[model samples]
Target: MTTLPASAHWQPALGGDGFVEGIDDIRQAIAIILRTPVGSDPLRPDFGSRVWQYLDWPIDRARPHVVRETVEAIRRWEPRVKVTRVVVALDAEAALKITAYFRLASSGPEISAEVRPK
Candidate 1:
């Protein structure tokens, strides 16, 4: 069977200093975008999602904003994937539970990325 070229591309792993490839990289990328507060990166002030601003609001109120930010941020940062849906819910601990569903631009199966500020 032919190996998927997606496996060749990779990104630096979160925390602990390692690298991640394939879907893991994509997942990490989304997590990074959501976790980073805007303007935190001096070189790329607009590189992250604005969802953090709405994290304090009630889930019902924040859902749309969170979805918008998630979609926009992924569209801007990760051109390889086209986000199809974003799900925002409240965690048991009263934290945000965001999940973005997307399909690879190259025409593959849909995938999802769970995002949190941790």
Candidate 2:
């Protein structure tokens, strides 16, 4: 299990988006991973997630896909944490919203990040 660097645990200050250290950084990183389409990056073809493919798919049908894609991507890319749960839902606009819950692999409180993958 990888632990966040000592500075990272207390480094981030509140930003305009209300993101802080540990949570926001991890959240943002996960969001980026999920937003990126596999094979888009020329150098690392396998550095992204497949969640975006299901964007056009119906939410009910896409839920499992989102959950699976996110869990695996997080597991592979972010060694600092382990995904515990991923919830998929639709907003009033019918857009998809993915909320993921995870904790540091080295042990810590569970943290959740909500990402509306485009």
lDDT of each: 0.85, 0.83
**How do the residues 76-103 of candidate 1 rate in per-residue lDDT, one tens digit apiece?**
9998899999888877887789989999
Q: Estimate each model's TM-score.
A: 0.88, 0.82
Among all candidates shown, the one with the greatest lDDT: 1
The Cα error of candidate 2 at residue 36, in Å, is 0.5
User: What is the Cα-based TM-score of model 1?
Assistant: 0.88
In model 1, the runs with Cα more than 4 Å from the true position are: 1-6
Best by TM-score: 1
Candidate 2: residue 51 lDDT (0-100): 93
Clashes of each: 1, 0
- Model 2, 45-82: lDDT tens digits are 99989998899997788899889999999899888788
